[model samples]
Each structure stands twice: as structure tokens, then as C-alpha cells.
Target: MRVLTVNAGSSSLKLRLLGPNDEVERSTDAEPGVDLEEVLRAWPAPEAVGHRVVHGGTRFTEPIVIDTGVRKELEDLTALAPLHQPKSLAGLDAVTAQLPEVPAVACFDTAFHTTIPQAAATYAVPGEWRERYAIRRYGFHGLSHAWCSARVARFTGARRIVTAHLGAGASLAAVLDGRSVDTTMGFTPLEGLVMATRSGSVDPGLVLWLEEHEGLSPREVAETLEKRSGLAALAGKADMREVLAAAGRGDAGAVLALDVYVHRLAAGIASMAAAAGGIEALAFTGGVGEHTPEIRARAAERLAFLGLAVDPARNDTNEGEITAAGAAVRTLVVPAREDLEIARGTRAALR
Candidate 1:
């Protein structure tokens, strides 16, 4: 079966055409993005279409066939993941309008962390806020984490693994027996490790203080945190390449930015690894994890105490085997296959 996978972002749409064997025949990004109708109009429609829905909330713990009720629930979830859900449903509507008889599946980023223990997910708050408001953590990047974990199982036959999906939007997950035990992304994508623009893990009191003292509205605060912070706010640019170059040229802020980013990442990974008891293998995926050799090298260096060390030469050249021979913990760079995962998930749902 051929499946067309759509991941709709706030400003762009990522797409791929995948077959039953999980190979991408064609993949592309479109922007100023087009809707699903436009996408389908350009290519042959697949047996099914898989939509990447960012937040399923508590209602959905697995992929589900789209229906009117599901659509409404997804619409309601927009408030929870304002950066993603609107565009996702817009694409979903376009596809449903164009291919009414076709099966469409919603694959959620939150679903993979459904098994996260309450101790890890709960915030220190009243029961009313926790239960009625659904205010516990719901980690994102489920697709990438799932793909990398499965790849680790294939490569090492390891049941305990840590997958770092690093990119402009980054997260780490601890996988035990192929299930998510813990993840860095929490409550929202903004609550994880620092990203291109998103401020990860800031004190909630700071937000309330800003609103009370600075007279900033909730929307303004959200925009600042989600769109104006992180590497961009600290170092003048969010692109890692630029940050590294600036740091090499003696930009203190750039140097500090990189330090904070790596430290937070290492800390999160260490925490997740502890949750799963011990990590048998470590996998890196997504844009930064797969492409930025410097980031990977630095990360591995910090994690050497965990019995992982990278071969500097291999790490510099983007080789999948970054770990040195005889390393206690295997380290690999697994290019994320979210498209394939989406296709497989959607195919299964369609059946």
C-alpha cells in the first residue's frame, strides 16, 4: 500500500510518499504551504492519507480513523497545541473534502507518551487543575521517537534505548521494551529542551509575574516563549551553524547559548535513561541529531560517563556508527523516518 503522509506546521507543510515497504519514493516540503487538496491534486492519491496531529489530548492514545466526532475533538485540541493543530485540521479538512471515500488516519505525537508513569507526568498542582483541566504532561515528537526506537531494536536488538530527536524542535525519550517510559517534551512542546525559538522548561511563576507586572497578555507571553526565545533570543540566530560560527569568533552569548542547549539536552537524556533503569543503546535522529556532527560529538563527550564515546573521525563525517569500537554503550545516528512510520500507522488503521 502507498500512503501519503502530511505533517502540517504553522508556516509550512512537510510531505512524503511512502510504500508498503516503508521507503519514501518522493518527499518534499511546500511553503508558503498548500492545503491537502492542492497536494493531492498534484500527485496521485494514495490508498490512505496519514495526518500528523500534534496533540491528541487525553482522548486519543492511539491512531484512529477520522470521523465527525474525532474532527471536533481535534479542533478542540487546537488550544492545547496552538502551533500545530490548526494547520493539521486544515489539511485534514482539505483531504476529506477531496477524498471523502478514502480512509484518513490521525497519528498523534502525544500518543507515544501515554504510558508515561504519573510520577513523571504530573505537575505539582491541585487535583482540579490536573484532572478537570487535563494539565499533565503530554510529550511531543512521538513519531520520531517511535521510528528511532524501532530502528534501535532492529540494529542492536536492544529493549532499553534512548532516542534523541534533535532539531529546531527537540526532545528525548526513554524507551523500555518498545514503550515510552519518559520524555523531555512535557505539557506542551515548549516545555522540553530548548529549541530554535521555543523556551523549554521555564518557571511558571515567571509567566504569571510577567502577566501581572509587565501587563503582557497570555498570547503575548506565548508568542515570546514559542517564537522569540531559545537560541534566537540568546545568540541572535537560531540556526546551529550560525551559532557555532559566532561562538568560534568569540561571541559570549553564542557560547553560552550552546552550553545551555547541550547541558539541558544531556540532563534530560540522563533523566530519561535513569527512568528506564539503564539505556542499552543511544540513538540520535531528526535534523540536528542526524546532520550536526559537532552537536553529536559534544553530546557524546558529556555522556562518556555513561559508557558512550564517539569516534571523532566518524562523528565529524556523519557516519551512523559514531561510537568507538568496544564502547560499552552503542551510539548511532538514525535518520528519522517519521514519514514511514506515518504510512505504516495509517495503513494499519485503514485495514
Candidate 2:
């Protein structure tokens, strides 16, 4: 099946046409206001299209063929993923308008984590709030985590694995027997590891204190935490590469930011290992995970207690199976391939 995968981000739209064997036949990262229909017309027409929807919420647990009803349901989920859902809808509308005859599938980033057990997904909150709001951990980056976990399983034949997706946004997933048992992201993408711009896992009381004592409005607090915090707040830059460079130049803030980032990352990995009972394999994906060897090395050093070690040579190489010989846990790097995962999901749903 030739599948065209559509991934909509905050600032760009990614379109990839995959051949039957899952090779990328054509692809493009179109910025906002690009003529999507014209772009689609320029390529070999895809037999089917798959849209990467960010939040499936509690209802849509799997990929389904997009239709009038499904589109409405997705719109209803906008509140759950305010930053991403609308973009997804816009992408879907544009592509479907271009190829109305072609079948379209909605492959959700939240779908893969739907297998998370109730206990792990639930929050320790009031029953009324939990019931009324449907408040629970709905981990993001499922498409990346799903692909990485399966790739690790294929490489190491390990059923217990932890896959870290570390890019502008980051999260860790604990996959046991090919199912997501637990993950770092919860309820929203803002709940996990310190992102490029997001302050992850802050105390609820601090928000309340800022609102009450500091006289900051709820919107002001949210904007600061979501946009002005994290590495940007610490190092005055959001890109990890710049942060690394500054730290190397003896910048105190960048050094502390890197330390805090690695600390939270290692701690999250350890927690995921606990969730999966033990870690047989550890896989890293996303920009920082694949490109920044220093981040991986620092994380490995901190997680040495879990038998995680990376050969300096292989780590520098930044390729598969960077794990040292005889290590109890196998660690490797997998490039993020959410497009391929969406294609796979689309084929499966159509089948």
C-alpha cells in the first residue's frame, strides 16, 4: 500500500509518501500557508492518507478511518491538546480536500499509550474532578515511542524496554511485552521531561502560589511556564546545541541547565525501569537523543546503577547498539520515524 503520512506541527506540515515496502518515496516539510493541494498534485498520488492527530482523548483508542463523525469527535478533543489539535484538523482538511476520493486514517499520538494500566494512568485527585474532567495521564509522543520500542525489540529481542523521545519536546515510555505500561508524559505533553520551552512536572502549589501571592493571572502563569521556562529560562536559549556550547564556554546558567536536564532525564528513565519491572533494553530517539552524545553520555553515567553503559566510541558514532559489552541493559539509538508508524497504522486500519 502506498500511504501518504501527514504530520502537522505548531509551525509546519510534514508530508511523506511511503512505498509498499515502507521506503520514503517522497517527502516535504511545508511551512504554514503552503498550497498543500498543489503540493499533493505534484507527487505520485497516494492510495491512502494518514493524519497524525495529537490527542485521541479517552474515546478513540485506535486508528480509524476519518469521516464526518470522526472529524467532529477530533474537534471535540481540541481542549485536551490546544496547541496541536487545531493544526492537525487544518492539515486533515487541506489534504482531504485535495484528495477527497482517497481514504484517510487518523493515527493518534495518544493511541499507543491507551494500553497503559488504569492505576498508572489515573491521578491521585478527587473523584469528582477526575470523573467530571476525565483527568488522567494521556502520554504524548506515542507515534515515536511506538516505533522506537518496536525497533528496539527487533534489535535486542527484549520484551522490557524504555524508549526516550527527546526533541524540543521529550518523554519516556516504559514498554512491556510490546504494550505501553507507563510513560513520563501525563494528561498533557507539558507533564514530562523539561522540554526546550516547557517547564515539566512543576508542583501544583507553585502555580497556585503564583496566582494568589504573586498576583499573576492564570494565563500569565501558564504562558510563563509553557513558553518562558525550561532551558530557555535557565540558559536564555531553547536549543540544546547552543546550551551545550555556552556550557563549554564556562557559562554557569547553561551548565546548571544541562545538569538539571540530565538529572530529570535519568530520574525519569529510572522510574520507567521500575514501571516495567526491569529494563532489558533502552532506546533513545528524537533530536537530542540522536544528535547530542553528551546528553546521552551524562544520562548513561547517572543510570550506571541500572547496568546502562555506552561505549564512548559507539556513543560518539551515534548509531545503533551503543551499549558496552556485557551490560545487563542493552541501549541503542533509533531515529524518530513517526511517519512510518503512521503509515503502518493506516495500512493496518485499512486491512
Candidate 3:
């Protein structure tokens, strides 16, 4: 079956055509001016279109055939993920407008972590907030976590693994028996380790303090935490490459940013390792994890107590296995494959 997988982001749209063999037939990026119709028309007629919906909330636990009720529920989730949901829904509409006869399925990024226990998913909020509002942890980065876990299983033939998907929006996952038992991102993608622009975790008192001292509203506080904090606030830039360059030039702010980012990352990974009882192997996937050798080296340095260390020469290059010969656990860098994952999910749903 030919499947068209759509991953619509806030500012970009990525679409890939996958055949029955699970290989990419064609892939392209569309900008604001690009015609969605022309893009879909260029690909061979797909049997189905699978969408990567960013937030499923509590309504969807698996891939579903889109209908009126499904569409409305998806729309309702837009408030949860304001940045990506609108674009995802628009991508779905665009695909349907072009290929009305083909089946369309919605696969969620939150579905993989649905099995996390209540203890890990809940917060220390009041009972009314916990039970009435569903105010609890709903981790993100599930798609990347799922893909890396499967890849680690295929590569090392191991059942227990820890996969860190570090990028602009970073998160770590603990996979036990090929299932996600715990993860770093929580509730609103802002309750774990620091990220490119999002403040991973902050004291609630800080929000009230800002509100009283600066006369800021709750929405302004949200924007600052989500858009203006993290690496950007720490080092004046969100890109790790720029941050490293500045640090190399002896910028104190940049240096501090790097230290905090790496330290927090290591702490989060250690927690995941503990959750798995002992990590069999560590897989790194995502933009930073796959490309930034310095970050990988630093993170592995912090994990040496666990018998994890990366070979200098191997890490300098972008090779997969960066672990030393005598290391207890393998350290690897695997590029993420979310499009193929979505297509596979859709194929299974069709079956």
C-alpha cells in the first residue's frame, strides 16, 4: 500500500510518500506560499493518508478513521497544542480535499506514553485540579521515543533501553520490554529538563512573583516560559551551535547555558536509567543527539559511573556506535524516523 504521511509543524509541513516496502518514494517540504494541492498531486495515488497529530488529549488512544466526530474531537485538542494542532488539522483537511476517496487516519504523538502509571503522570496539585480538570502529566515526544526504542531493539536485540530524543524540544524515554514506562516531558511539554526555548521546569512561585512585581498576566508568563526562556534566555540564542560558538569565544552566559543544559540532560537520563532498573544500551536520536558530538561526549562523560563512555575518535565523527571497546553499555546515535512510524501505525490500523 502507498501511504502519505503528513507531519505538520507550526512553521513547516513535511510530507513523505511511503510504499508497501516502507521506503520513501518522495519527500518534500512545503512553505507558506506553496500550494498544498500541487504537492499532493505530484505523488502517486496513496491508498491512505496518515497524519501525525501532536496532541490527542484523552480522546484518542490509537489511530482512528477520521469522521465528523473524530474531526471535532481533534479540533477540540487544538487548545492543548496551540502551536502544532492547527497545522496538523489543516494538513488533514488538505489531504482530504485532494484525495477524498482514500482513507485517512490520525496517529497521535501521545499514544505511546498512555501506559505510564498514575504516579508518574500526576502532579502535586489539589484534588479538584487533579480529578476535575485532568491536570496531570501528559508527556510529549512519544513518536521519537517509540521509534528509537524499536530501533534499539532491532540493533542490539535488547529488551531494556533508554532513548534520549534531544533537539529543540528534548525528552528522554525509559523503555521496558519495548514499552514506554516513563519519560521526561510531562503534561504541557514543560515539566522536565530544559529545552531550546521552553523552560522545562520552574517554581510556581516565580509566576506569582512576576505577576506581582512586573504586572504580567498569566498568558504573558506562559509565552515567556514557552518562547523566551531556556537556551535563548540563558545564552541569548536558542541554537546549540551558536551557543557553543559563543562559549568558545569566552562568553560567560553561553558557557553557563551549556553547563546547565548538559547537566540537566544527564540528570534526566540517569533517572530514566534507574527507572529501567539498569539500562542495557543507550540510543540517542534527534537533531542534537545525532549531530552534536560535543554534547554527546559531555552527556556520556556524566554517565561514566554507569560504565557508559564514548570513544573520542568515534564520537568526533557522526558514527552510530561511539562507545569504547570495554564499555558496559553501548552508546549510539540513531536518526529519527517519524514519517515511517506514522505510516506503519496507519498500516496496522488498516489491517
Candidate 4:
């Protein structure tokens, strides 16, 4: 079935019309202020519409048909993913408004990680708080991770894999036999490896201390952690490419930023490997993961203990299996394909 996938980001909306054979028949990236109706009118109406919803919370674990109840539930989840859920809802509204007759599915980023075991998903918090708030790890970037893991398994025939989805935002998933056993992201997208702007895995005590001693309001703390931290705070630039360039120029801050970034990434990969028992294949996807050979090489070097090493020439090629000869672990670079995953989920939901 032909499916039109809608992926809404903080600043842009990505629309991809996939043909029955999964070819990208047409695609467009609409920034804020673009007329959604006009954009939809320009393309052929799709038989189905699939939306990339950031948070499905504890309720929705798989792709489901978007209906009055589902829409309401999704809206209620806005607080869980305040930065992304509204944008997704807006995109859903726009597409359904343009083609109300087409079957629409809400494909969640959290769905794939729903299989994570309780030992990994549960937080070491008060039972009352945990039960009342449903606070647990609900991994993000799962659609990308799912696609990468599947590709890695097909390419290397590995049952245990670690898939890293690195971009403006980043996370790693430990997949065993096609199911997510553990992941870096937790509760929200801000809990994993250092991202473009988000501070990953900060101490709760530090946040409370700022509020108690520094007298910073909750809003201020949130804003700083979500928008003013990470590589941006470290190097004055959020983009990895720019940071790498600055580092190459002997910029101390950029060099330190890259070091910390890779450190956290490698450590997270090790943790994921532990969760999956061990890593047989390491797959990289997303913008930085696919294009930045330096980051991949650095991460591989750190993970050498796990027998993960990339061939210098293959890594430079920036795609496909880049595993070094005689290495026990295979390494691959897979382009992010959330649209295709969304399409697959849409077809399954409608079927």
C-alpha cells in the first residue's frame, strides 16, 4: 500500500510519500510557517497516512489507528514530550484535515522499545512515585534504531546488536533478536547520550541544588538543560561538523567537547552491550552517524575492547559495512529511514 509518512520535528515537518514498493515517490521538508494544506494539495493523495509520534506513554505500545480516543490520548501525552508531541499532533491534524478519508496511523518512537525488560526500564525510585507517575524508560529514536537494527541483522546475521542513532539528538539501542532489550534514552529524549542541545543524564541532585541554592526557577533550569547545554554549551556550536572543524583548528573547547561526546557515546554503547549480553554488530544511523567518519572511528577505537573496529578505508567510505578484517564485531553505517518504518507500521495497523 502507498503510504504518506509525516514526521514532525521541533522546527520542521518532513513528508514522504512512499510507493507500494517502498520507493520514495515524493518528499518535502516543510519548515515552520509553510501552509500544510497547500503542500498536501500538491501531491497525490495517499491511500494511508502514518505519523511519527514521539511519545505514546505507557498506554500505546504499537501503531494504532488515529481516532477520537487515540487523538485525545496523544494530546494528553503532550506533557511527556513537550518539545515534540505538539508538533506531531499538529502534523496529524493537518494531514487528516487535508484527507479525512484516508486511514491514519500514529506510529510511535517509543513503541519499538516497549519490549525492554523491566530490569532496564524501571527506575530506582519510590514505588508510590513510580506507580503514580508511570515513570520508566520510554526510549526515543526507536523508529530509526529499529530500522538500523533490522538492516544490521540482515547484513551481518547478528542476533545481538547495538544501533546508534546520532544526529541533533542521539541515542543507542540494544537489540537482541530484533527486539529492544535496552536503550540509552529514558522517560524522555533528554536522558541518553549528550545531544545537540539536551544535557544527557544529569544528576537529579544537581538540578534540585540549582533550584534550592541558585534560586533558578524550574522553567529556567529546564530551558538551560534542554536548549543551552550539550555540545552547544561545550563548544559554542551544536552541529558536530562545526565542532569537529573547530577542534581541527586547535580550538580547546571544541576538542574537549568532542572528547566528552565520544566518551559518553562509547560508554553508552558498552552499557548497551552489557544489556544485550554482548554486541555482535554495531550499526550507525542518523545524520552524524552516517556522515561523520571521525566520530565513528573514535567511538570504534574506544570500543576496541569489545572487538569493534572499523576499517580506515571502509569508515572513510561513509556507508555499508565498515568492519575491520579479523574483528569479532561487525560495524555498519545505515542511513536513517524513519519514513519507511512509519510506512510499515501504517500498513500493519491498517491490515
Candidate 5:
């Protein structure tokens, strides 16, 4: 079935028209401020519409055909993923408005990681709070991670893999036997490896102390952490390209920012490898993961204990396998394909 996949990120809104076999027939991107409804109205309605929703909370574990009730439920989830959920909701709304008769499916970013074991999902909070608030790690970037793991399996046939989706937002997924055993992102996107702007895994006590002593409002703290922190706060730029350039110029803060980013990313990779006992293959994906050879080489250097080695020549060429032949663990560069995953989920939901 033809599926129109809607992927709205914090920076851009992309729409892809996929053929029956998931071949991209047409694709277009719009700025964050463009009217998504107009974009949908202009394109021919496909057999189904697939939206890349970032969070599904506990209610949505799989792709669901959209309706008023489901839309309401997703609306309620906006509080969970303030940055992504709204854009996803908007995409759904646009589809419903432009193609009222067409079936639309909500493919969640948290769906793949639903396989994460309970031990990893649970948070160390009060029983009442845990139960009442649904306080647990709900890993994000499921679409990217899911696609990466599948591709890794096809390429190297590795049953145990660590898939890192490093982009403006980053996360690491521990996949074993093609299932997510654990992931770095927890509760929300803000809980894992340092992202472009989001401060990942800050001490709760420190934030509370700052609020109590410095008189910072709750909203202010959230804004700062979500938008003003991470590589941006350290290097005065959130885009890794700028940071890398400045670091190349011997800017101390930029150099430190690059160092910290790589450090946290390498640590996250190791942590995920431990989740699955060991990693047979390491896959790098998403924007920075697939394109930045330096980041990949640096991370692999640190993860040498896992027998991961990056062949500099292959890494520079951005080939399939960047790892040296006969390395215990193969390292790969898998391009992110959330659009195809969304289309697949939407087709399944239609069935």
C-alpha cells in the first residue's frame, strides 16, 4: 500500500510518499514554520498515512489507526514529549483534515523499545509516585533504532548489537536477537546521552537545589535544560559542525564540548553493550552517527575493549563496514530510515 509518511522534527518537517513495497516515490521537506496542512493538501492522499509520533506513553505500544479517541489520547501525551508530540499531532490533524477518508496510523518512536526489560524501565522512585505518575524510562527514537537494528542484522547477521542514533537528539539502543533489551533514553528524551541542546541525565537533586536556593521557576529550569544546555551551553553552538570547526581552530570551550560529547557518547555505548551482556556489532546511525567519521572513530577507540576498531580509510569513505576485517565486533554505519519504519508500521496497522 502507498503510505504518506510524516516526520516532523524540532528543526524540519518532512513528508515521504512510499510505494507499495516501501520505495520512496516522492519526498519533500519544509521549514518548521510551514503549514503542514497545506503540504498534506497538496500531495495526493495514499492508501494510508503514517505519522512519526515521538511518545506514546503506556497506552500506545504499537501502531494504531487514528480516530478521535486515539487523537485525544495522543493529545494528552503532549506533556510527556513537549518537543515532538505536538508536531506529530499536527501531522495527524493535517492528514485527517485533508484526507478524511484515508486511514492514518500513529507510529510511535517509543514502540520498539517497549521490549526493554522491566528491570531497565523502572525508576528508583516511591511506589506511589511510580505507580501514579507512570515514572519509568520510555525510550525514544524507536523508529531509527528499530530500522538500524534490522539493517545491521541483514548486513552482518549480528544478533547482539548496540545501535546509536546520534543526531540533534541522541540515544543508544541495546538490541539482542533483533529486540530491544535496553536503551539509554529513559522516561523522556532528556534522560540519556547529551543531545544537541538538551542536557541529558542531570542530577535531580542539583536541579532541585538550584530551584530552591536560586529561586528559579520550574518552567525556567525546563526551558534552560531543554534548549540552552548540552553542547550549546558549553561551546556556544548546538550544531556539532560549528563545534567541530571551532574546536579545529583551537577554541578551548569548543574543544571541551567535543570532548565531553564524545566522552558521554562512548560511555553510553559501553553502557548499552553491558545491557545485552556483550555487543557483537556496533551500528552508528542518525545524522552525526552516519556522517561524522571523527565521532565514530573516537567512540570506537574508547570502546576498543569490545573489540571495536574503525578502519580510518573505510570510515572516511562512509562505507557499510568501517571496522577492520576480523575485528571481534563489527562496526557499521547504518543510515536512519524512520520513514520506512513508519510506513511499515502503518501498513501493519491497516492490516
Candidate 6:
């Protein structure tokens, strides 16, 4: 079955046609408003369509055929993931309209994390609040994590690994035997390791203090953390390349930002290892993970305790394996491939 996968970002739309066995027949990158006919004109008609929905909340845990009810539920979830949910819904609408009769599936990024135990998924708050709000950790970047887990297993033959999806938005996953036991992202993408623009985990007390003492409103706090903070707030920009450039020039703010970024990243990786009992390997994906050699080296140096030394030579290259020959635990670099996983899920849901 050929599956056309749609991943709509804030400014761009990515389309992929995956063959029955997951081979990419063709792909395209177009502006967000491009017509669906243009995306499909170059390829044969797809048997199905899979969309990358960022949030499913608690109700939808698996890929399901997109129907009227599913669309309504997704619309309801818009507030939960204000950044990505609307774009995903818009992508779904485009594909559904273009191929009205095609079987469409909603492959959620949160679906792969449904396996997290309640202890890890639950927020430490009042039962009343938890029950009333359905507040809990719903991990993000799960499709990337799932793809890393599967690909790393095939490459390293390890049952337990910490998979880091580091990019503009970053998260780590503890995968045991191909299942997600625990992950870094929680309730929202804003809670986890340091990201490009968003501040990761911040104390609840600090948030309350901002609202009460600093006289910042709830909306102000959200906007600050989600957009104004992180590397951007620390240095002057959010782009990792620019941050690194400034850091290289001995800029104190950039230097401090890099240190804090790597520190939180190493801590998250170690936390994930603990969640999996012990780490047999570590897998890196996403833009930063696959490209930033310095970030990987810094992280691996801090994690030397786990014997995860990266071979400087291998780390410089793009091949999957990056671990030193004698390191106890392997380190790998896996490029982001959420669309492939989306295709796999869509096929499974229909088959």
C-alpha cells in the first residue's frame, strides 16, 4: 500500500509517498499554501494518507482512521498544542479535501508514548486537579523517538537505549525492548531539556511567583517561556549555529547558554538511562542531534560515567555508529524520520 504522508510545519509543508515496504518513492517541500494537487501530480495515487498530529491528549492513543468524529476531537485538542495541532489539522484538511475518498489516518506523536507507566505519566499534584484537568505528561516527539528506537535496535542490537530528539524542540525517550517506558517531554513540549526557543523544565513555584510577584499574567508567562526564553533569552538568538558562533568568540552569555544546554541535555540522558534500568546505548536524532558534533561531544563527555565516549572521527561523519571502539555503551546518530513511522502506523491501522 502506498501511503502519502503529510507533515505541515509552521511555515512549510512536507509531503512524502512511501511504498508498501516503506521505501520513499518521491518527496517534496513546498510552502504551506501549496495545493494538494501539485504535491500528488508527480506521483501515482496513494492508497492511504497519514498525517502527523502533534497532540492527541488522553483520548486518542493510537492511529485511527480519520472520520468526522476524529476531526472534531482534533479540533478540541487545539488548545493543548497551540503550536503544532492547528497546523496538523490543516494538513489533514488539505489531504482529505484533495483525495476525499482516500483512507486517511491520524498518526499522533503522543500515541507512541501511551506505554509510559502511570507513575511516570502522572503529575505530582492534587488528585482533584489531576482528575479535573486530566493533567499528566503526554510526551512529544514520539514519532522520532519511535523511529530511533527501531532503527537503533537494528543497528546496535540493544534492548535499552536513551533516544534524544534534539532540535528547535528537544526531548529524550527511554526505550526498553522497542517500548517507551519514560520520556523527557511532559504534559507539553515546553517541559523537558533545553530547546531553541522554549525554556525546558521550570519550577512551578517560579511560575507562580512570576504571576503573583512579577505581576505577569498567565498568558504572558506562557508566551515568555514558549517563545522568548531558552537560548534566545540567554544569548541574543535561538539558532544553535549562531549561538555556537558567539560562544566560540568568547561571548559570556553564549558560553553560559551552551554550558547550561549541554548540562540539561546530559542530565536528561542520564535520567532516561535510569528509567530503562541501565543504558545499553544512546541514539541521537533531529537537526541538532545529527549535525552538531560539538553538542554530541559535550554531552558524551559529561556522560563519560556511562562509558559513552564518542569516536571523534565517527562523530564527525554521518554514519549511524559514533561510539568509540571500547566504549561500554554504544552511541548512534539517526536522522529524523517521523514521516516513515507515520506511514508505518497508517498502514497498520488500515491493515
lDDT of candidate 5 at residue 324, scale 0 to 100: 82
Ranking 1 against 2 by TM-score, winner:
2
**Candidate 4 residue runs with Cα over 4 Å from true position:** none
**How close is every model to the real structure, measured as TM-score?**
0.95, 0.99, 0.96, 0.98, 0.96, 0.97
Task: List residue ranges in candidate 1 displaced over 4 A.
Answer: 33-39
lDDT of 2 at 192: 75
Give the Å shift of residue 16 in candidate 4.
Answer: 0.5
lDDT of model number 4: 0.93
Q: Would you list the clashing residue pairs of candidate 5?
A: 137-187, 138-187
**Candidate 3 per-residue C-alpha lDDT over 177-220 given as tens digits, one digit per residue, 9 for 90 to 100:** 88888899877788788889998888889999999999999899
In model 2, what lDDT does residue 317 have? 53
Model 3 worst lDDT run, 10 consecutive residues: 316-325
lDDT of 5 by residue, 80-190 (tens): 887778888876676577778888899999989888998999988899998887888899999999999999999898988999999989999999998999998888788
The global C-alpha lDDT for each of the candidates, from Candidate 1 onward, is: 0.86, 0.93, 0.87, 0.93, 0.89, 0.91
- Candidate that beats the other on TM-score, 1 or 3, i.e. the better one: 3
**In candidate 1, where is summed lDDT lowest over 10 consecutive residues?**
31-40
Residue-wise C-alpha lDDT for candidate 4, range 145-238, written one tens digit per residue? 9888998898889999999999999999999999999999999888989999888999999999999999999999999999999999999999
RMSD of each: 1.7, 0.9, 1.3, 0.9, 1.5, 1.3
Residue 169 in model 6: shift from native, Å?
A: 0.4
User: What tens-digit string does per-residue lDDT give for candidate 6 at 1-351?
Assistant: 999999988888799989888899988887855776876776889999999999999898889999999899999999888878999998888778889999999999998899999989998889998888778899988889999999999988999989999899999999999999999989889998989999999999999999999999999999999999999999888999999999999999999999999999999999999999999999889888998999999999999998899999999965478999899999999989998999989988998
